[model samples]
Target: METYDKIGINYNKTRKVDQRIASIIEENLQPKGINLKLLDVGAGTGNYSNFFSSKGYNVTALEPSEIMLAQASHNNNIKWIKGSAEDIDIQDNFFDGVFSVLASHHFNNLQLAISEINRTLKSKHFAVIFNADPSLVSKKSWLFDYFEIVFEKAISKYINIESFKSLIQSTANTHVKIIDYPLPDNLTDNFFASGWKKPSLYLDQTFISGISPLASLETNTLNLIQERLENDLKNGTWNNKYGQILEENHFDDGYRFLIWQKP
Candidate 1:
């Protein structure tokens, strides 16, 4: 919860759900009715909730981080419940659809979340969840593969698509139809996790928000990490193994979005 209050400050930075990805999610994860009662787990900062609420659907935001819920309350539009997906106190079969983005990896009790998801939704209900590349625990990216060694040493393990299947499905038949929305870039282990440092124009607070997903690190800690990364970039240690990237923008990693339905 503490992390979110701090993390929520920069939550919208590099992480707006790409409309390209959102379009696919919207197409497949659509509710059955116009005024559908929807649930958004890990609704950080209310960006996505606000987006859906704009369209006239009732969106209930369930976020574990109290700080995030506070920030999300900036808009008085949605129902903000301070709870994780696993421990959601709402009633059974309470929603037509449920969705969350970039917050799946932070789940402490993933199985509980899955069980809760199943318990809360009636038959025919759907839940959509999206998270970043688990293997991409490093800082380097297609734009900045040079920093991989540095970042790889400093990151933690992330959740993958297969883990979603194991966590959510009790039976083989009641499964999540996984759709991995990979970034439209190199998939090899050579690319960086954070991507190149962005073009000169993109290096402002925008960079702070849109750059790193390092939500756990404080500002000072983040600075130390960046300081080392900059040192590596300058000393040419990064470029020796990974060459300077010609292009800086436009990347799409196979960051998966698992779409589950109950019959």
Candidate 2:
């Protein structure tokens, strides 16, 4: 019945953990060795939460969707909690750090959520947020060329990086640092822009459905796009236009990480 329930079990199938992203989060947070407490707001299937917990940090995986949480892997080290970003149930100044990956757009009230995150973190610690900036994403992403509807919807929903920074600044008393986190050509995680270099992978039904924005699209629309893309690939039209990506190991795709620290 939940918004994300439709893709519950299938969520983890394509959405695996990418160490590159994990390492970036860890580096930004700069955890104080083992047993440090961390909070993962909007933790869909607890991918990052599980990874941090395995690294010896006590992690709280906070997710609003019950169906998605039901499918999350249980770990003794990670505590899975059902809650929304606007109102975290935990106590004040309880966590060493908090991070949200590609989930801020889901928050009904981003300022309130940032305030909640700011309130929950220990002073001088960090809260890291990662997402794609719509303005920048429109530049080089091929998804716009294929699935036009999905891209339009995503761009409308996602906040621009500058506006996001300003929102965090207004709501939280933290020093904000913006970091560019471009997707590697062979990224293990199957997020929206992950298939930038590997264009043909987007043709797979299972792969397309696993992506949140595209999954929300109508079946007919998806099928039409797939049909057109398949034809383009068969006739070499795709490579003729976007062949440069095949040689590159990474693409920017407007992915960014915002590190907020209370000082």
Candidate 3:
């Protein structure tokens, strides 16, 4: 069974598509052409796939977990396929473009996945939205203070941005243009770092369960983190150290858009 099959029960509740991020995805892929044939790799819950389909693009939503795909919206415009990125069943050069959001870390083999992406993509460009290495970002995030183990696990899983770019270029002969995506205070999609400003959201199991690192934690660790955070918030210790972040409307919590295009 896929990992999400166990942990993704409440995924759609909090993992809704943020329009700001969706608009950026649309804008970047727009140049490909109207009604282009697109593929959404690792299409969790099909949020972005449904978004693109609603915009008139013919989208093929590929996912490995049946549980995740089961939650996808019923859309005639999307053809949902059960598959992994390392071995896409599609034919060579089958898609006009492809995109994946916050799903690459779950891939069993990054190199095979990139090769498969390149093999199936006929167009010059594809987009991926991934987090910066947790090691670097954790230093600036209060989340590390509360859930140190979560960040430690994430650091082992997330690829370094520079190394990721190099891997893509080597595998696909594509140029990578990275754009920084700062988290908005009112971000609708409650991703892992989305609670940078509103720390209380992390205390909610429903909210944190949607995030892989947090969801993967043992019950004892989760309880300990919660207890510490609750204590800090009650005693103003959290505010004392990280309260200044509340003044900012947006934070560069190390989310980035990596646009890979053939030069």
How close is every model to the real structure, measured as TM-score? 0.75, 0.96, 0.95
Q: In model 3, state the lDDT of residue 61.
A: 92
Spell out the clash pairs found in candidate 3.
none
- Candidate 1 clashes: the total is 13
Off by over 4 Å in 2: 138-141
**Per-model CA lDDT versus the true structure:** 0.61, 0.84, 0.82
Report the lDDT tens digits of candidate 1 across residue range 1-263: 65566656655544454455555656666667667777878777677787778767788888887656655644545888888876988888888887877666667777777777767776787778776654543334533243343344333556556765666666323777777554543222112233433322222444454333444446675666566556766787656645555343434444677788866
Give the alpha carbon lDDT tens digit for every residue of 93-203 in model 2: 999999988889889988899999999999888899988875676544466778667767877888889989998987885558899986787777798789887778878
Quantify how close model 3 is to the true structure by its C-alpha RMSD in Å: 1.5
RMSD of candidate 1 to the truth, in angstroms, is 5.0
Ranking by lDDT: 2, 3, 1
Top-lDDT structure, candidate number: 2
The C-alpha local distance difference test score for the whole of candidate 3 amounts to 0.82
What lDDT would candidate 2 get against the real structure? 0.84
